[model samples]
Target chain A: MGKIKILNPGLLSTIQDGGRFGYQQYGMPVAGAMDLHSLQLANWCVRNPAHEACIEATILGPTIEFQSDTYIAISGATIQPFVNEQAINMNAGIKVRAGDVLSFGSIQTGCRIYIAIAGGFDIPELMESKSTYLRGNLGGFEGRALKAGDELEIADYERRLKGVVPEELIPNYSNFTEIRITSGAEIKRFTMDGVKTFLCSVYSISPQSDRMGYRLSGQKIEHANGADIISSGIVTGAIQVPGHGEPIIMMSDHQTVGGYTKIAQVISVDLPLLGQMKPGDQIKFKEVNLDQAQQLLLERNQWLKQHGIE
Target chain B: MIEYIPSGDSAFLVKFGNEISEEINRKVRAYFIALSNKKLEGIIECVPSYTDLMVLYDPLKIQYKSLLKELKILAENISEIEIPEAKTVEIPVCYGGNFGEDMDAVIAHTGLREQEIIEKHSQNSYLVYMLGFTPGFCYLGGMDKSIATPRKEVPSQKILAGSVGLAAEQTGIYPIESPGGWQIIGRTPYRLFDPNRKPEFLLQAGDYLKFYPISEEEYYKLNEND
Candidate 1:
């Protein structure tokens, strides 16, 4: 067993695993890490299962103190990380000696960062998940974001080994801003012009965005058919356009059901990219067919497996 | 009738016509029951709403195309499957006065006497169309059109659990304290949702609810035991 002490928890930090499943009927949102790709990569670096609990840091990163020797990895947003004033590379596992201080600077790109320690974070499971649902105040460190001075226990790992992730394996941040999406149920309701505008125009992430949803400020994509859609179940990455025509991308903490007309849905593979986007970040949507989207996901999964991440 | 289409990679939406009607609501409930019984693999959950059903699945185990194909087949076969009658539960409620702060507003909107409104509300049997918006919150159908009224102009910041409310042609019971826009006319003592319970939600989609008016004395009696 190991322990970590937070010296300065920046912005919002919480323990998250994959998500809470099999509870939609009970009206529980599937709360988890926003940037799942980075979370998995960090976990893989430490040889932990891809779904183990990790620290999801948003906007800012935390300063931590290690009470015992352990291996840790940082991924997602480009944060200049250091251990006792020595710079460390992101995405590769680093061995930290007892009493060493681990700190991170402001993010250079992206909004959220994921930190994975060997084994995983020690947190109680609620409804079979360690993910925190802030709305309901359930799971993960008393159902809230981690604050300064909070001590976190680390699960014991059977084996602790330093691992290196090649630079080629890391996602190219320059090409990471573009998001792929599949047209939604109400796609036909919009005119051809509306569709064209949605694909061509750039949208800025609104400051109102949070875990519940990301509201976008962009070109108005009107519904030509003037049909009032009935309420239906919504998932993460759903781009719902309300009466005002502004699109809102549902996030991990989005409501189980909504009545707005969804113009498109961000592909699952690119959802993590959307998760890392901060307020005022410009985003453009590229439409792709379902087959192509699945193919992309399959290729990504295979790449991870080939790199010993599975 | 309306068409069903893909909402996202993991879910499909079965949409009904523009207006909310009993026929469409019943079909949504029946289809939900049919899908629940089928127990398709990789399917995580299904949620029924006012006039639609959202089916969520796992993309890893099931591809979007294959799941869509299965859903098309399920949609065609839904009418053939027999739907079981919902379980009828009588919920005791305390009407008017401070218990229902918006009782006067409902009366003024409907132009009906307080007693008449209560009689009409309690006399009808409602079907639980869905559980959404909040935890254990039930969206009930079969409300009489005469008492139909729009939602409040400004929603209340806090509505106590077990508060009975009406919005437009729909009525529901709040399972937990939450912000709401519906006109509240009464309060029930029964606990609609309790996380500590095995099932968590007392009423599932497709259940039947009947309101039974109770005096203040009976309300306190039930509250005392709980």
Candidate 2:
């Protein structure tokens, strides 16, 4: 069995897969990799399945020591990775032997990084996913962030696939990001002026942002009526406007239901861009129709399929 | 008439009404049952809330327009949909002690005695509106507003699992230990969430919940069993 020992746990690191499905009705948040595009690309570098669990490090990354031979890939962010004191390339698979030290240097850009092993992490799956939901304390590495001295078991693979992802597929995670969105279910609750203000104004990510949701501060969005609404199911990327008028973008670990008005939903194609945003990052919303958003999703999926990354 | 709204690329909201009512909840449940029974291709799951149901689907397998057409037809005849009888769960609580640190505050808010509060709370059966906030946490309705109290000004740092709390027109049991602002008045020994259990959730959206007062001795007995 392949194994690795964590030395420095960094800021926030956890195991993640596609997400925990079939449990949202039970109030279980679908915790998954925030930057799914990077997760998929990392897995592809090692020739692992798209849904395989990977280590997601936010802002900072961990120092680890490999205990067995394995092929691994690091993607997302501009974190400098090293193997046994030798610098390695990002978005490329590398072979590590037993006792090799794996570490990361400074993060040059983006907020999160993904590391995928050839055969994935051998972790227990709750609700059919290894994704960790820390609040619920279910799934993945005992349902919490990795700490020093934690040992992770890796699955065995007969052969290793080593390659680098071409530059065309890699996303540029800029500090100032333009997140595209479609009008939400309660868009009508806002006045035309409110919608225009929302689409035009720039917002800064608040420090309180986490996997649950990103609290944004910007110009107040004036609603035609009070912001209260009957509680309804909420999905990831939903931009909920509370009585305070600030919009909060729900993320992978967001609550299943909310009572505030949702003015927009960041389109699927731009959710990855939102995921890479860190505190103090500036974002502006660009409106797109539902058809256009879906078409974008279709195009993204087609690209993933053609590139054999899905 | 049912209204369909786009939630995101992968899901859509089927709204039954703008108000929260048992009739509206029943409609939500009816449609959820119908769609669940049909096992429509590409539909992943349905989450039922107070007045709407969020249907999640695989975009690769189905389109929102086609799914909306199917939902429109299915929702039209919700009155005819048959679902399994909702289970009425009896949750035992020991009130007014260390278990309920905010019991005196609740009495002050409602101008009612401790016993009166307990009696009123246990006498009525509540409907499970939805499970959210935390795993297995139920949002229940049908509380006697006479004893209704607002949430604590400052929420507790940590509330143990199964703590029954009352907050502005609603009452619920915390299924897991979490930081909350609810005015806690009691605790139960029953486990609301067990990952090992087949149906991890003890209650569903349409289930009925009834709280009964239990003695401290009985509480210890049940706690030991868990």
Candidate 3:
């Protein structure tokens, strides 16, 4: 058992696992970590299950004090994390002795970060998940962002006495900024010119983006008809265009049902890439077939397993 | 009959039509029951919405093509299957005054007396078409056209739980406190959604609902009893 004390809860930080599934029938959103890839990588570094509960730090991160000796890993955005004012390396497992102070600087590229502990953060599960839903106040640390002075308990698991990390298991965060997308159900609703514009033009992430969805500011994609779609189940990476042609990519905390016409869907393999993007970052969408998307995901899974992450 | 389309990488949607109709609603409910009982492997959940049913599945376990093929078969088989009998529930509600603030607006829109509207609404048995918009919020069918009214232009910041309201052709009870635009006529004391409870939701889709008007004293007494 171990404890972590928060000294400076950053912009937004919350405990998250995989997600809440099988509850969308009751209008519950599948609230989970935005950047799942980073979460998995962080957990892998700590020798924990990839889906184990971890801290999802947004923009910046809180100053933390370790109450006991534990192994930890940091992934996602280059936040320039430090321990006792010394720069800590990103994407590598490190042992933290008791009373060590950890702090994070402003995001240099991405918007989010994941901090994983050896045994994972201990939080009550709701609907088979530890992810937080702020709107419903359902899971993870009272279903809200972590605050200063907050203490978190770490689950008990078999720990490795010797700190052993493979050299090649480290992830390259530089190439993940680009996002890939697939054609959505309402893709045909947009004009041929609109589709061309979507694929060709570059857009910037709007400041209004959050866990619910990322609102992008770019050239308005014109639709052929003024059709209002019925509210239906939406998934992460669904690029929904409301009355205004500006697209919003639905994320983890997005509503179970949405009425906007979805023009494109960010491919599952590239959703993590989008998750790392911060406001003002330039983004370009490249179209890919479903088969390619599936292949990419399979390749990613194989890569993880090959590196000792099951 | 409706067409099933791919929603995303992990789900498919069966859309009935653009307009709302009783026949289509019943078809959707029956199909939902059929699919639930079929129990396809890798299928995580099936959610019935206003005019569509969304099916979520584990992409790692089941390929998209095979799942779509199975759904197509299910859609073809839905017409021959019988829908299960729905449980009948009698819900007690307190009309107007404090609990329902939009009673006057509903009365004005319908151009009917408040008592007459209450009598009409309480007289008919409503069918739970779906549960959505919020946890335990039951989307009910069978509202008399005479009392049918449009939703508020500006939605209220907080509509109390169990507040029964009408929006266009549909009427529903708010299971949780949320921002809504429906014209509320009454509020129920029974908890619609309690996470501590075994089932969580008090009602499910396809359930039969009968609203019984109660006094303010009765509402408080029942609340205290629970």
Candidate 4:
């Protein structure tokens, strides 16, 4: 099988796909790529189906050597992906020769970068996905982040895949972002004044944040009754408030259930932005009705379909 | 009251009740099984907790109102839904000493002798409320309040998998190594979660779990096979 040999596994690089579902019933988390949109965008360049397994790297990235010729694409975060010190363009398919070394430079914009090959990663699928759940040591290239000396096989495919994301379709990864969220199921659990304060607050992403959830520190919102709730299902992007009154936004690797009261859920369209945010980035919440939030999701999907990349 | 609450754009939170009990959880499991049997279009996944069943769906395939309408119809006669009989699983736990670091703390907190604490913990059967918080981590209910203790002020940075612990009125097993505040009383030899194995999880919701005390030698002897 064709392979990519890892030379240096930068910060936190792992294989990920759409997500592992249907297993959440058994207490499993739906671990997937932090930025599904960017993963899909990179897959688009490689002519693979959307949601194919790809390498997800944090702000820093890995140095890898191609063991065979294939088309590769880089998307999200300007990591300055280079082949033998020669820079490659982002969002476009680039051809590589056997033994060519690909390394990354400092992150220029986004917090995460997705790297996709022509035929996707050839890791064994567990629970119908290649995404890694680090906590459980399940799935994805031996259930953990990539390391130096690990050889990852890629599916066999041949094509100088030609694709490029349109300017408007690219994500804007500014330090300060305004995210839109809909009221959570337990919205009334918090004081009306608390809800208003959340909308008006500008929170800085806490340093402790990771794939499981993003911790935000800002104004402490008041709970009408208390912060505790009967443990219930927690969806990705749900902003849960605990006794501390601080909000924790669930992310791709969020657990199946939580006991804290969730104040709101970030709209689906805006979720990808959370994946690209780094520690200390300022975020402010905006309110959108459920109808408007769903509309935004549909519009985003429509755009992807319109571009023949759905 | 059965209420349909808003979650996010792609899902709906259908709450059965506001509290955790066998009666309410049975309803959750019944609906989970019912929704599973429906093979409903656009429904991605259904996760049942103590009192809520969150149905995640694909907005591109079905709208919120349409899915809500379908869910209401299915829920109208939900209590009548037949659920599978509960399965009883017996777990052998070795309590106190190194296997249970917080055993002394628990004994002090409850003011009970070591043997009494062990007997009380193992004697009562706990209902598997839900399998969550971590993969294959069973949310057990019905721990004897005599041994009930509050969670530690500072959660351990890493609690090993298969550690049986107590928090408030609950006793749970850590299916995987994770940071937790539960007071550890014992450790189990059983691997509650093994991804490579068929079935993956040792316990599921709608099951009964009874713990039996085991000697340290027996714990290592049983664990050696795995």
| Superposed Cα deviation of residue B80, candidate 4 (Å) | 4.0
The order of the candidates by DockQ, greatest first, is 2, 4, 1, 3
Which pairs in model 3 have colliding backbones?
none
What is the C-alpha lDDT profile of model 4 across B1-226, one tens digit per residue? 7899879898899998988889999888888888888899999998888998999999989999999999999988766777678888999999999989999989889999989999999998889888887799888888899999899999999998889999998899988888999999999999888887788888888789999999999999888223
Give the poorly placed runs of model 4, Cα more than 4 Å off: B95-115, B149-159, B179-183, B214-226
lDDT of 1 by residue, A6-68 (tens): 998888898888998767765778899898888888988898989788999988888999999
Where model 1 places Cα greater than 4 Å from the true spot, the runs are A1-3, A67-69, A97-99, A174-176, B1-4, B15-19, B79-82, B108-113, B145-150, B217-226
Clashes of each: 0, 0, 0, 0
Find the candidate with the highest TM-score and give its number.
Answer: 2
**Poorest 10 consecutive residues by lDDT, candidate 1 chain A:** A168-177
Ranking by lDDT: 4, 2, 1, 3
Fnat, model by model in order, equals 0.63, 0.73, 0.45, 0.80
Give each prediction's DockQ, rounded to 2 decimals: 0.60, 0.76, 0.58, 0.74
TM-score of every model versus the real structure: 0.91, 0.96, 0.92, 0.93
lDDT of 4 by residue, A1-310 (tens): 5999999988999998999998887999999988989999999998988999999999798899999999999998867889989988889988998999999889978799999999988888998899999877888999999999999999998765589888788887899999999998788999989998899989999999999999999999999999999889989999999989899999989999999998999999998898999999999999999899989988999998898888
Mind giving the per-residue lDDT tens digits that candidate 2 earns over A1-310? 8899999989999998899888888888899999889998899899998878999999998999999999999999988899988999889989999999989998888999999998998887887899998878778998899999999999997687686888888998788999999889999999998898899999999999999999999999989899989888999999999989999999999999898999999988899888899999999999888778888889889987777777
TM-score of the A-chain for all models: 0.96, 0.98, 0.94, 0.98
